[model samples]
Target: MARGKPDLAALETRIGRDFADKALLRWALTHVSAAAQRPDSYERLEFLGDRVLGLAVAHMLFEAFPDDSEGELSRRLAALVRKETCAEVAELWGVGPYIRLGEGEAQTGGRKKRAILGDICEAIIGAAFLDGGAAAAEAIVRAAFGPKMHEAGRSLRDAKTALQEWAQARRLAPPRYRLASRSGPDHAPSFELAVEIEGFEPAVGAGSSKRAAEQAAAAAFMAREGVTE
Candidate 1:
């Protein structure tokens, strides 16, 4: 069963934001499965938070990389605002314990789910925005993502996109992915996929999701081919 009310005060301290209206924070942490109504879930907040994160990250990139071209800035923005980055931020904030998941989702390890973590991260940003405006949202985003933004040698392109571009530059056909195998239970399945490029051996990767497996395969292929960003 879902737990009683989570300690939002501790969550606020961790994320470095205090909500004027605590209900928004509660709503932000609420998963759809635990919500009495779908609208009461974090979905709406997530949508708004996604936009807020993009704008905040874009602005930060503009100021931080004065010498970077528009394309470079765009790539950096993409990296910062990606779901993976958001999920990392959520993990850093220790948000999992506070998420309100239904019994089934809780049992299935929904707290550790990448998608859920990322969505709740954005939802928290949305709540911050609603409670204290853009400044509040940007503050939280900066505190969490700012250090990562300045990290040198970070690959802006996701592995799949990077691999595709690598193949195109070499006049090779686009890489193709095939599902090699799937294992585990329905709630926590693992996927194995192979990515093949012309004139090269296929690289295999495994992950909890097909897209992740595909990206892993692409990264593996690049590694084997001595490709680097």
Candidate 2:
């Protein structure tokens, strides 16, 4: 970590709302990797932020999608909590540019890392909650997620879950994923997969990793099924 402070002023601009307790915002942006190098990193605050984030999202989903079952709400929450989604949210404010990273973490694309960005976003919410309470956090959440929530209402479906639900509801067998193989160097690997749905032709998918490939396969199957609801 650098001896000097990370720019809270810039972060406030990114946040679009200032914190009463500025320290909370500082801690929220602080990453564990950064903290290891910096005097005060955001892990502790991140932990609090993680819980606050989950709760805030859960409450919002519960209220907004009244007819949605717990399972449905959980699915939406899962989609939002993923590193990919969080990183996209951070990208809105160029939040990555403001992170205080350790010497090593900085060198290897830490700024754009999805896991780091997601964690930081959660920590910031935690910080916001601490400084300004649920109301402030809610404002941020609504603004950040407004578009996606509206879109989800028009058409919302997750392939993996949809496939599972399809099988269960029809009293058919569940889908199966076969990791056909993986290749590439240790730093990066490519995965090939074949998803076998009973009574249907297998679907193939490739991804940077096995899990990703499986998800892709699931999505393929979902598309084939014309997934809805």
Which one wins on lDDT?
Answer: 1
- Candidate 2 collision pairs: 1-37, 30-42
In model 1, what are the clashing residue pairs, if there are any? none
> Compared with the true structure, what per-residue lDDT tens digits does model 2 show for residues 103-216?
666776778766677767877877788888888887777667655665644334456667788778988888899988888553334688988978888888786556667778
Give the poorly placed runs of model 2, Cα more than 4 Å off: 1-6, 37-40, 152-229
Predict model 1's lDDT versus the native: 0.88
Query: Who wins the TM-score comparison?
Result: 1
Give, for candidate 1, the lowest lDDT window spanning 10 residues.
Answer: 1-10
Q: What would the per-residue lDDT of candidate 1 be over residues 193-224, giving only the tens digit for each residue?
A: 99998799999998767877898899899889
Q: Tell me each candidate's RMSD, in Å, in order.
A: 3.1, 5.0
